[model samples]
Target: MNQRNSTQLHPPTRHFSVLLSPTPRGARLARLLATEWLRTWELPHHATEAAEHLVAELAANAATHGRLPGRDFRLALLAGSETLRVEVTDTRGDDLPHRRPATPDGESGRGLLLVEALSDRWGVELGPVPRKTVWAELDLSPEFGNVCSGGSGALLQETREGKKPHQAPPLPPTEPAHSRE
Candidate 1:
């Protein structure tokens, strides 16, 4: 008699993406959606909170600095066994983000500072004509192991099933904000 051992292979990456209008309301919605998704994935509490802040900051920057009339921005979350990456892509390819010291009296300009402090790694990627992506990564704690073992698609399905009462509605598809030069 021969016996075969069983093993299951899981994809190493899980991803979620959405497009939203470049508005303050859109940015707020991005943060809330990210928070809900992270919670659905069952990530560590600290990681979830930090990722929420990162999403808020990056989304706000896209809405404030990278906004183009009639254009929408995209928010994406990619989770691996060891890292979770948050990215916000906008149509403003020429407007690159920079880190600057905030004055004590200034009311704003501290978003990137908070991102730098909270994320394990963060950077801006400019390319593919008329678009730029600002991304931040949080290192997953070993204690949590693989938070997305079941894959993000399943978690998204669960979110859509009204697991939470306050889950945001899905965003509609958007057209290109501007033509390629």
Candidate 2:
């Protein structure tokens, strides 16, 4: 027999969730899975690409800075009419993330900075016990395509011109949109 729920009668709200071990491999998996799910949801290339890196950065932080001896992290993706939210919850509630200035010559510590540049808005949420969620949201409105047409390229250009990211202008539509992941 066929069974149907209320949401099944209409367009189901898009969401994906998973728990993964707190390890480097797990962080990599989180990015891969989110990318595929975003594609399945039919998001435009820009949203999918931004979300993929957002998930990667959050998951990497969870695995690197939030790992507990035996606990895993949770990854969740929720898509609304005009936004996609990515959340990575780890066991280190005491270790809230703060955005530090990006170093021009450093090898690491740029994850959160990238997250801020890519996401429309992002912040940390402390919770029930032994857990904290680092979340970022990307705009998926009609303007998304035009807004991020240059993606990381524009950010790089700003740096080369000695302009801080905040001092730079919105990315111009210099390239046709395409999926990078």
Candidate 2, after superposition: displacement of residue 26 in Å?
0.5
Q: Cα lDDT of all candidates, in order?
A: 0.73, 0.74
Tell me the lDDT of model 1 at 47. 76
lDDT: worst 10-residue window of model 1? 172-181
Clashing pairs in 1: none
For residues 1-181, write the lDDT of model 1, one tens digit per residue: 9999979876578788999999999999999999888988887776788889889999999999999999999999998876788999999988777655689999778887777667656666777779988887765653233232122211121222333222211222331111001
- Model 2: how far residue 71 lies from native, Å: 0.2
Among all candidates shown, the one with the greatest lDDT: 2
lDDT by residue for model 2 (1-181), tens: 9986655343456999999999999999999999889999998788898899999999999999999978999999999876688999999988777544667898668886687667766666678788888877765653423446233433322222342322222122542222121
Question: For each candidate, what TM-score against the reference?
Answer: 0.73, 0.73
True-structure RMSD, every candidate: 13.4, 10.7
